[model samples]
Target: MRTQVAIIGAGPAGLFLAHLLARAGVDAVVLERRTRDYVEGRVRAGVLEQGTVALMERLGLDARLRAEGLVHTGTNLAYDGEIFRIDMAALTGGSAVTVYGQQEVMRDLFDAAESRGVRIVFEAEDLRLDGLTGDRPSVAFTRNGVAQSLACDFVAACDGFHGVGRASIPADVLKVYERVYPFGWLGILAEVPPVNHELIYANHAHGFALASMRSPTRSRYYVQVGLDERIEDWSDERFWDEVETRLGPQASAGLVRGPSFEKSIAPLRSFVAEPMRYGRLFLAGDAAHIVPPTGAKGMNLAVSDVAMLAEALTLHYAERDASGLDGYSARALARVWKAERFSWWFTGLTHRFPDMDAFARRMQVAELAYIRGSKAAQTAIAENYVGLPMGFGGEPSNR
Candidate 1:
């Protein structure tokens, strides 16, 4: 098979890229190592930045998102038993975030792409890229135990952190910056109304807790846990107790307890790979960078990455231009590092460190107090939460 682009992974980044390329009349093929069901069911982040929402609308793939997504103008930050609300819309010039699951976004992208007859091959195995430095690149893979080769003008490595995309690049050519947190989040999805209407990030003496929701009736919550803690160690009742204790009295009063259907612990980490391009191969989303879930920037970052990439590729094929493609790495990384800083800062603010001394804890309290008392601090928080403009300066022109 020959195409203009060979995309690996069926996640949001890969699928969105394929859809964008299709609309631009660029022939591209997507290869997924998992089935469609598996791709659509993977539970991930649920917050969409304003720019992401706009991009989805521009693509005409947000009918369901517009109807079902919870539009939040603000988010709550709790510390010292007091809740501080940052008016995201007010502080960010009427910008707001949409509470929509990453999986749901993938589903929407998949439907939009499939209806347009974009080529997507599932259950692909042993995917490999070759000749990325040359004028042409090819992806070798297997489907149903049969060998296959896809020749393309370029390759997109959206296969994620553990996938072959970043690994394919020689280590010497890449500079990696990473920091793994000392703890993890024990998250649960339950069938109950959320503790509050908007997402809440709570800081308590014990740990950090978050109250968020997927929909009106389905809630997603998380409590900080030790790195050694296992899902099997906490029962439903115990988890609820931990949540209530950490969220303080006001926010926990409305908490509804129910049997959780999904429980898992995710370790926190901040990571970024410099120059998100390698010859003819470009990496977007998790394949290029990762941020801790504190700022809810992971999926949104992926959206922006592809938005820029798609625009660049569209220009290349449509107008015979190469400037956008040439600058993709610098443009994308400039925003990536800002997100990393925000996620790291927010994580430190809300999470209790294992080695936190009295002075450190006091600093945490003082910082939150300053944010709560100062409009400037709140505005900064709100700006990052609602998301910076696509390029961190002006609105992205992709849409």
Candidate 2:
């Protein structure tokens, strides 16, 4: 098969790009190693930054999102169970975040792709990219034990961190920066009303805990755990007890406990691959960077990567301009690094370090107290929470 762009992976990054290209009259095909059911079934982050919400509307896929998404104008932070609110919408000129699950976003993208005639190849195994350094590039993969080849003008590597896209870059040409945290988050999804109308991030002597939701009826919560912690040791009763203790009585007063349907532990990390473009291939989403979920920047970061990337590709096709493509790496990395810093900072503020001395604990308390009393501090937090303008400063603002 021949096309203008060969997109690897059918995740949010890849699927979003395919839809954008289709609208711009660019021909592309998406290849996924797993079935659509498997891809959509994976439980992931549930918060959407305004840019992501805007992208959905621009693609004409926001009908369900607008109708069902729970909007939060503010978020809460707790220092030893004394919670303080950060009015994100009021502080950021009416900017707010939508609580919509990443899985739902993928489902909507998939359904629209099928109806809009965006092509996606599922169960495509062993993807390989060739001639990325040359003028033209081609992708090869096997499906159902049969080999296939696709010729394309460019290759988009949205396959993820373990995929062949970033790995295809020469080691000497790629420089990586990463920091793995000493703790992981033990997260659970339960069928119950959330304790509060807005999400809460708590800092306790015990650990860090987050109370969030997928919808009003489905609640998602997480508490920090040591690296050696095991899922088997955490029962529903024990988990709820930890939450109640950490959240303090004020916020936990209305807390409801129920049987958890999904539970897992995920390690946190901050990672980035310098120069997102290597020849004809471009990296977006997890392939290029990862942020700790502390700031809820993982999925939102991926969306912004593609939003900037899609605009670049659109410019190349529509106006015969290569500047956007040439500068894609620098432009996207600028935004990616800011998110990394925020996630790292937020994690440090809320999580108890294995090596945190009393001095460090006091400093955290002092900082939270300062933020509570200072409008300037709250504004900074609110703007970052709502998401920085797609263009950090000098880049184009993506709609």
Query: Against the true structure, what is each candidate's TM-score?
Result: 0.98, 0.98
Tell me the tens digit of each residue's lDDT in model 2 across 106-225: 999999897787999999999899999998799999999999999998999998888899999999999999999999999999999999999999999999999999888889999999
10 residues in a row with least lDDT, candidate 1: 390-399
Candidate 1 local lDDT, residue 96: 91
- Clashing residue pairs in candidate 2, if any? none
Prediction-by-prediction clash tally: 0, 0
lDDT agreement with native, every candidate = 0.91, 0.91
List CA RMSD, all candidates.
Answer: 1.8, 1.7
- The true-versus-predicted C-alpha distance at residue 339 of model 1, in Å, is 0.7
Q: How many backbone collisions does model 2 have?
A: 0
The residue ranges of model 2 lying beyond 4 angstroms of the native Cα positions read 392-399
| TM-score of decoy 1 | 0.98
